[model samples]
Target chain A: MSDIVQSLEGLLERLHIDVGLRPILSLVILLAAVFAVICAALWGAVRARWISRNTAAFWIFVSPWIVGFLLFTGGPMVYSLVLSFTNWNLIDPAKFIGIANYKEALSDPDLGQAIKVTLTYAVVSVPLQTVLSLAVALLMNVKVRGIHVFRTIWYLPSLVTGVAQAVLFIWVFNPSYGLANGLLRLFGIEGPKWLFDAHWALATVVIMSLWTVGGNMIIYLAGLQDISKDLYEAAELDGANRWRLLWNITIPQVSPVIFFNVVTGLIYAMQTFTQGYVVTHNGGGPADSLLFYVLYLYQNAFSFFRMGYASALAWIFFVMIMVLTALVFRGSAFWVYYESQRPRERRRRVHVG
Target chain B: MSASAKAPTVKAPTVKAPTAKGAGGPRREPLGGRILAVTLLVVGSIGFVYPFLWMIATALRTPEGVSHGGVSLWPIQWRWSNFTDGLGSFPFWAYLRNSLLSTIVPVVAVVFSSSLVGFAFARIRARGSGVLFAIVLSTLLLPQEVTIVPQFILFKNLDMIDTLWPIIVPTFFGSAFFIFLYRQFYLRLPEAMTDAALIDGAGWFRIWFSIYLPLSRPIIIATAVLQFMSYWNNFFQAAIYLTTDRWKTLPLALAGFQSVNGTNTPLLMATALVVTFPCVLLFFIAQRHIIGGISFTGSK
Candidate 1:
């Protein structure tokens, strides 16, 4: 018996040539099996006529994405919701905790601070970005030669990746060996340590947010183009000069675009993460002035392993965005023009039924 | 309904009167008006262009040269090697390849999926399309934070960890904003084209591909450019899904460069410029299509 056990051990040792290759081979086999299953399922879907021929072609073209969304998005969304109700530390059996996660997230002080900072950023950045974009777009709309080049140049910064731009701004706002301070020196003004100072750290982020008006400006330029030349000509005859024209004609015509920008920008700014993540040394800088809501959520999920709490925070964010967007749309009837609205109203009155 | 009935009655008198009178008049730009316009244009242009130029200047300055500039319009030494040195300093080629691979698939996926779904919503009489579309649109309202945790957990269980699936798969779902834009555009297209195609026994996909996609080049280009830029700029997602240095995208690589070469302002600046150049080149190339897309979205 001892000799048989010794021989078996020796054979096992001989078979174990490389430790890494086993896992990799197993993984490949698993993936190949999954691919086969996916192929079979897709073939069934096609053969069943559940999807039309044309639709089949369309789906085929977008098959990679559909699989991705199902696995990555749909699958994750379901799992996350399930996770939010569980007390899984990623190792042990997940315990059902019900609403405890929600309560904890609400009570978390860091979460509150992050929410406050994000709201403040949204309030400041969204309006500033929208107004500035419109202002710049208006200026660019003037019938000046070579203005297209100017428009292109102005938009250059927006095209640059946010990571690179944020990095550049960090240097610009650096107290020492930065251009912002150097510019301040020219005017005999001492520059505050922009990223370091707690009082101004959030403000520094706000300023950075505003600097990327190029994206919004491009959108506003599109809005400007929608303003028919006939409308401007008509306004001119009434002696409505540029300011008056802009106030009455241009503003009203592009009000819908403004609304689009405002709502989307508000949502975007409220969820501001990248700039906040990069600038704040990964924890909101100094005293958490730059702690954005999404950043907080990220910290909870990744850094703290509070997955359940983070999920609760995410749902809260979703609810908030929905409410805010609904409010905007509800109020839009006062300003947003719909060509079909009047006719629909008229048709409603004519309905005998 | 009550508000709408009253609106036209109130504005109808004003709109009609203004429309005719406004059409015949040649706009007269007075000396004061001309000066005001020029001044505003110059100021706006300066505000827009100055920071970018400053960024470029900072990029070209040497470590010592940047310190000496002190708000000077131009760099002192113009350290050209900063660009080469910046490229050499990190796993830039790997990042670029990953970014390129990642960006291309998503762009193609989104364009195809969005158009198909958009056409269904726009022109077809599919049951529950409106409700389905509304659901799709609602996805835009959900912040990325809400989903990230779930997404991460999902990927982990699926053993998609350390893979690009987390970043690439979401693009297949089709963007709510882009789908909405395409839907609006499809609405504006002459309905006769679709009706004729239908009469000829052409399927919905045929009409979409043969008719819609062909005619919508301007918008398609515009959307592709925008998505391309968005994908290029994406950092947070890449930061989360990708951990290994080899798996990093361009934006991640750029951020690493900043963190490492941070003390040398000139080298950092040069790197920033080089990183940004490709996107700038893309924008210039697709400027017309982009402008067209912008106008279309705005007017709607």
Candidate 2:
């Protein structure tokens, strides 16, 4: 290996390539070499009639994803699991520690705080965001004039990038002269220090989460647009009031969409990092109230150089997410209604008769 | 019993009827209810739009004007030089160039590779394809945080840290979500379109490039728009990889600026606006495709 590398380096030097560009050039060359070998093998297989033309074409097309999956995602995932059992700080050599990191995690108060904060944020924000976005979607679903303009305005805030949103909201929630307190002052009420007060810090983040409810609102609008008009008309003919129509027909009709949004929203909310990181200037805001799970994991890995411990934390988080996702999916069968399932139901009824 | 036999046929029109009308359901709402909804929406829009107006106003204000200003939309004095000052505060142009390079390269790379893979997944039949596609879908649920550490280590070993390569190179492999989008789109295209080309002895690659790709303008645009927003707004990987100012992107620079100049409210807002304007412009120009792309994931 060393001899080949030395020869390659000599060849590159003879070519007079710049030092900074040498590594990238070598990588390209390596990838091309691998591609050549794979192509040759594939050609051999096709000539031998071991595989069909369509199979060869399929492999060629999907090679990028297969290569990328192994290099970027699959390999790293397995490496992360291995790292969880060892002590490596990015500088020194790694030493096998045999689950010491996980053992320590059991007694770690910081991890506990991080978990508590993350769960609270996800639990509080997910439901609130769901309800608020649903309400806005319902309002936007009506055939009012110029509803598009209102929709554009509502979604404009969601377009702001996370860092910019955090910076803008820092001013908006400024204790004395910011917009939140400024608006409150107009109503003869003094607002508490948001993003600064420990008691209100997480709550303030929850409020900030609602600003992007337009994202989910659009999805809900799509779901509402999908509901059959016949269901509403039938309900009305049966003396169903507006509330009854909404509760019975509309909700059930869109239940699958609701399930999707809630599952995705909860998963997203659990991984909160950017807002807290930006608002608190890379610290846990106000007595660790903003010590989100991912943020804590980040600090452990990058700030404190505890890569192994961070890997353990990441694994724990993975399991938590898996469990939560499974529970939601398992619960979905009870509540989510699929229009396609009606055929099966009808068949079953026919058999019963 | 007969109705039960016809249930599958009955389902098709009902599913598509509301969508054909361009709006769902009858507007049986009374005038009073309509007026109330319109009023509430207008009021709520002000709340949603007020912060942005305030941001622009504050960005245009003098430092003292911002400190003394109440909750007002109008600036006391328009300080146009704040933008220039903010631009000059750091290596703004260099960072902007870096940001464009990182974002644009990834956008083009992801679109090309994803569409290629998606076409194969949707159109071609091969053994083990089903399992491979399932693995691709499963990766969507894997939080990026789990892989960040080892990815950093991988880049570090490759001597690609502190450069844009770490951010740009991986995108060439294609992203899962974009591949899924392309797959969903290609699956809907009639197979006969490709069959004709194949019967004429055209290769699968040629058929995909000549026939399928031209028909895929909508998906391409939608993927590009969505990918552009994500790569441009990306912060986490940029923060980890680009540790040096030599190749820092705009968001990373902005974060550094905030830590140093946390108290410079006016200049900060001006800088933040500079970083934010492109995304807002893109959203307005391609919002139909953006919303369609998002809802496509939901409905499917």
Candidate 3:
């Protein structure tokens, strides 16, 4: 038993010293096994006589996605989990290294800070965005002319992304010549160095994120549109004040949308990568305040070729999402008001039925 | 339900409209208050819009004055030559072509595949599709970062490392988001529309193509425009896949320009504007569909 174990260890070390080819060969073998399993499933599905059973159309429609799922999503996820257990750069043969990657990840100082920065971004951005978007939507929901034009204009910033957005924002936040400072000059308020100062840098990103509130504004506007003016008139007739109507009617009416935005916004915030990356030229902000989670992960996987460690990081990220989503869904019963419980919703359902 | 709330609050464009709701049992707001409200809104609109206009104006200015231009809304010295100079920074036309090619192929593929699966999930009553649809919905939260390493390796194995195939092939499969959008649309479609076609002995393809496809022009266009904009603006995907200058998309090229001319503000703005204008123009032209698509929900 000892001799066998020694030989195995020696063989692994020898394989580890080999360049590129063995890892690629191992991946190809795995790919072949996956392909064989996929072929068996397809064969079994075909043998079920879906055509005669009248479900062939469904399979045909969904076939592309099933193949894609096997290749891209499910297969990769499983492979990544396996990769997490092995220490291999693309250039080296992989060797089993149990729990080492996750252990390293937990202790990695840069990763800990990155996680904090990401959380700070999410904690700051999500609630502020929810409130601000609803506020803007209420403002725009007025029965005024040309509101559509304003709505489109407000949405423009949200649509402006990628290199254009990054470059434009860098200019907008430039201390000496940026519009933020130039406008501040008009008000006799000097703007702080944004994106340059660590204290203000994450705030700069949050502010940049606010520009996209027009997206949530549109969703809220849709919800608000469903609230008939008659409800407001009735509330007023009942001696309900403006604030009372806003608090009681408008807030409840828009709560579902607000919930949707919160969930998506939280997810988007956790995965914040591109703008921060581009703004800092991928080095991260001053004092590394903008060193977000995914940025670090990307650097690990690609720049450093620490694929095993990055896979571990990816697994942790997936778990975080799963936990957060589960928690939100569990907690949503208290906050997310479903209209279906109301008589009006029942009437609408009846009409549809 | 009411013909229209004839209250002055809605009819009158005034600042004091806020108070019109329960203002001493019924009274219109003062005209000055209305003017103040409109003035505030108008000023806020300027703040929202002027930067884009400023971007366009700055793009036309000579490189020297933009630094000290003090956020001028108009070009001090119109140097249309900046556009030409900006184009000279890299292989601009090639990058534009690459962007168009990458986006166009994916747009076509996404539209075809999304609607196909959408039709299956929404229309065909088949076993296991519910589970499939649920999987699609849940995976919507799966971040791309988790798969980047394996995806890179997979493509590397396929010898597609530097090619456009790595970027565009996935779209040939359906995207979950668009599939969901199409499924929602199909599910909400009037049953009579499909039932009547079925009575005429239409096959699945006939129902989807002859009846549904023609009627789904708005959605198809909306999906196309959105997909094109995303593909055109995609930085992360391109950064991972394309290494050679020959195949770099416009966004990557724009980033390259930013790196090369880090201080040339006007040239950078010009290049940025040129790269982004197509998406803006698409949005402007199709504003209705884009907005309507977002606002659309299944309802009575």
Candidate 4:
């Protein structure tokens, strides 16, 4: 492999190509070569009538995703798994250390802190965001004048990017001179040093996460809008009050949407990095209270150059997300009311009654 | 009853029109309850909107006034120079150009590539396509972190690090999520349309390009707007790859600005606002498509 690469470099250098352009030139050449080979094979297969023209066309159309999947996703996934067992920093030749990185993860204090902080953030923030966004959705769902303007105002905050939000909130939560404290002072109360305070740092991060609940609120509103009016009217005719209507009709009708939000939200919260990274100024915040799992993994990868260990951490995080998502899916079986299952549900109720 | 019957066919009624009648027949809220709901919404809107107002106000304040922050949205002293001075102090235009290039190219690339692939998946019945489609959807769950380390290594080996290639190139291959979105959209497209084109002896590419693509204006706009927001706001991959100033994007540059000038609140807010304005503007301009794209993904 080195010999082939060396000769390719020799050929490029001999051609007097600019050094920066050589990589790009070679990549183009490699892609062209692959394209030609695939074309030839496809042509041969078509001529031989081994595959239909539609089948051949399908491959040609989808080739971009296939090539990308192999190169970027599938290849890297396998490589990352292999790297998790090695002792490679970026500078060193990879040495197969055989689970040393994973073993170290078991007792690594920073890793432990990261897991704890991340889980706490996810646990606290996901449900709060789900419920809060749903509540806001219900509020916005009310048929009132100028509701669009109000909805837009509520959603505008979610448009701020993560880094910008973190920076803005740092100023907002400034220990002595910030909005949170300024408001607290107005109420004749003292606010803790928010991002600067050790105990309050993680909670501040959670609060920051809630600032973007408008995105999910819109989703819930859409779900709420889709509920058949007959369901509500029938329940109302049976003397269901507003509270009971919300509980029995609205909640079950939107449970699928709730399931979707919770799953995606949990996945997203677990991978939280930009907030912690920006808030802590690329360091763990306030004695590592805001040391999110991805941030710690990032530190290991880029700052510390522990590529192998970072890959191990990445896999562990991946598994944790998968397990959590699976648990949610398992639990959703009981609470998630699918409209398609209504027939069976009615039959079951009939038997029970 | 008439309004509720029309609701299902309207396709994204601006608001829940049926809820008015469905809550109870021709009912008005009690005056007290109405007042309470109004107050709650107003207060909630204030909570959501005040930080942004504070940001703008602080950006206009002198550095000293910023440090003495109060809950006032009124600046004591207007420092219009904060925008000029902040722009001058940082390479804002250069970063903005890089941001636009990375974002625009990917939006165009992903839209084209994903739609093509999505068309094939939705219309074509090749033997392995079902499994391939499944694989595409499954990739959506594979976290980017799981792939980032090796991808970094791969890009490094390709000598593409510290450049925009790592950030922009993979997007040309097509994104799993966007592909899925396009697939869902195309699947709903009537099969008769494609069959008519096919019967006219049009090729697959021609059918996709002429018939389906023209008909797919809504999904196209939705995907484009959504992609624009994501790529514009993207920080992590850009942070990993574009280590040099030559291709530093707005979010990364703003984060750098914050670190270097941590104490300069007015300047920081000015720069942050400049970085954030495009997304905010896009949201207002294409609010329907953005909201539709998001809820479409959720409901489906």
| lDDT (tens digit, per residue) of candidate 3 on B54-84 | 7887788776677768778878898888889
- Where is model 2 more than 4 Å wrong at Cα? A1-11, B1-23
For candidate 4, what is the DockQ-based docking class?
Answer: medium
Residue lDDT tens for model 4, A1-353 = 23444466668999998987777666667667777887788889999999988889888889889889988999888889999999887886999999999999999999999999999999999999998999988876766777778778988999886788989999999977799999999999999999998899989988888888988988887788787778877887999898998888889989999999999899899989988888767887989988999999999999999999999998999899889999999999999999998899899999999
The most accurate candidate by DockQ is 2
- Model 3: residues >4 Å from true position, as ranges? A1-52, A343-353, B1-37, B297-300
lDDT of 2 by residue, B1-300 (tens): 121232233221111211223646435578888898889999999998898889999999998998778799999999999999998989999999999999999999999999999999999999778999999998888898888888888777666789999899988989998888888888876676677667778888887887777667667877898888888888888878898888999988888888789888889999999999998999888887777766776767
* lDDT of candidate 1 at residue A278, scale 0 to 100: 75
Q: Write the per-residue lDDT of candidate 1 for residues B140-210, one digit (tens) a residue.
A: 66667667887777666544566676677667667767887777777877677777777778876677877
| Candidate 2 clashing pairs, residues 3+ apart or interchain | none
Q: Looking at model 3 chain A, which ten-residue stretch has the lowest summed lDDT?
A: A19-28
CA lDDT, candidate 4, residue A65: 92
- Could you give the candidate ranking by TM-score, starting with the highest? 2, 4, 3, 1
DockQ of 3: 0.28
Ranking by DockQ: 2, 4, 3, 1
| TM-score of candidate 4 against the unseen true structure | 0.94
Give per-residue lDDT, candidate 3, residue A333.
Answer: 82
Give the alpha-carbon lDDT of every model. 0.71, 0.84, 0.77, 0.85
Q: Proportion of native contacts in model 3?
A: 0.48
